[model samples]
Target: MDKKLIGAIMAFSLAGSLLFSGCSSKNQNTGEQTAEESMIQDVESEVTLGEYKGLPVTVEKLPDVTDDEVTDAVMAAVENASVTGEITDRAVASGDTVNVDYTGYMDGEEIPESSVEDYNILIGSGVFFNGAESSLIGVMPGETANISVTYPEGYPQEDLVGKNAVYQVTVNYIVSEEQAELTDEFVSQISDCQTVDEYRQMVREALETSRENEREQNRRNAVWDKVLENAQVVAYNSGEVQEIVDQYTSYDQSAARDFEMSLEDYVQTYQGVTMDEYTAAIEDIAKQEIKERLVIDAIAQAENINGDNATDEEIQKCSQQQGYDAVDAYKQDRGSDGMAEDVKGLRVVDFVVDSAQITEE
Candidate 1:
């Protein structure tokens, strides 16, 4: 599955933001019903669930972490913990990060906009103009050289595009990285473990735990996929679908605001789609999400695990699982209805998974 589609599915699966409209009160005179109850009732009325229990699913068997993988993981941790220091003994070389002061000139006239002082650039990184950083290679600190660079076509500055410019660059000290030795001292500094062997065992155990978690997640996904495949939606509730679409749109609008771009521009730039295309895609995703929610609700209703009647103890347990200090805080963040619906959906998933006949491949 596409990562973006997976993210969208995960976002919708939470049930926190999903709200349905156009549902009648269960009690006409009292007219007091939670939104979650109305939503579940609306979904149950709209969707017809297929066989969910005892569904057959096949998932890949978990693989054991190999010695080579453990070694690689240890090396990666050490590499990430490397410390950088100045290398004044060597001249600038390829892949070296060096500091420099430079002024650019076009047609023998200085370009004020291109001049920079004490700028740090990685050699061959192309941070400076074409061939500018490359020219610094073999130049020692305190040395000055005139390097010519040609700006490529379609450069941000149209006037400088395809034009040659001379830069009088003075080389500064190069930055070098030092990797920590794998010894008891280093191990004690990095972790509670005081020996290299102990650190290796710790890393191996962590990797095994991570792999096991991945395998479990894959199994759960397989079960959910089978359940979704077996389910059927009789008809989509337009009000609910529109509500989900609105939520999706609002999320995109917020993302656009974060990027400081207009919605149309953001969609076009990041999604590579016109507003119409994006809207259509969002609608399709919303409909699929609604179908999934409807199926989950249908299962919850059939199994007598409806969220509307969730006990206070259940809510408190859920709040603790969500890492909230108190139920009140959790309820304030996720509305009471949303919290209950999330708990209900989780319970339904657990039930379906337990009932599933799973085979490891």
Candidate 2:
């Protein structure tokens, strides 16, 4: 998960619902396999109404895929499905940390909650806010933040314009993220692919595909913005607050070259003069990610669109598929599977196809 990719996805997710992220935002799984089972049992009654018998069905609001907006997205992906980055900047190492500062404000207010200073953070640690740390990784210590943007219109504060909120950030630390010395464990990360290039390509495609899907979601959400203006979207946050804290640490590692430094060295390397400065920044980003995730989950549930399903069997397969002794380690955080999240994304895609009057751009 490249930070750029994650940042792009998060931004896309926030912008979408109708246009940026297709449905929901990024993912965070922790004890979800176990938690979903319990959640499922608590409300078994709801599903009794009847399964759609089609088993693994694809529902569409449109009559045909040929002339529908869905195809527009598919065709766009097919046309642009290729890797094209020059790696303009290469880091001395993936696990390097320097110094950094950020001026975060809510809307137009110089609110401290929105601002953090001299924040020191580990490169691969899930300490900074959404996409921020990841994006900052490859950058030089004196460089600006990789992912900077203004708060969106629909964001919490009415005062803040959803324009780009820029920051002067630095890469306080750098470590070699070069793939593990092609060891059994390292090879195992991409066991799903045949070769290293394949592995990288697969990862690249996964990222591109995610962005493409989010775009479709955004378009669909836009249609819904007009259609479901008054729809009672759920506004509750379920799931532990710390769940984010623990879950991202691992994901952050996955995004960068699995940071080479220990958490302590990683933290101290960042130029942020104070611990509060560094931590507060990460806290804000993480919270935004949470909000984006829940929003998508809620929207997905309202519509019947389904994305990837994490059934007990799928979990087991993922475990064996990756040659891991236990699949649980990979997805120890998510809950009840992302049923709500999948449904939201699916429905939004379907809605856009069903409603939007698309003309090729």
Best by lDDT: 1
- Index of the highest-TM-score prediction: 1
Candidate 1 lDDT over residue span 171-247, tens digit each: 86787778877888777888999899999999999999999967766766778767766766666666776776777
TM-scores, each model vs. reference: 0.58, 0.27
**Cα lDDT, model 1, residue 109:** 95
TM-score of 1: 0.58
Poorest 10 consecutive residues of model 2 by lDDT? 43-52
Error of 1 at 3 (Å): 18
TM-score of 2: 0.27
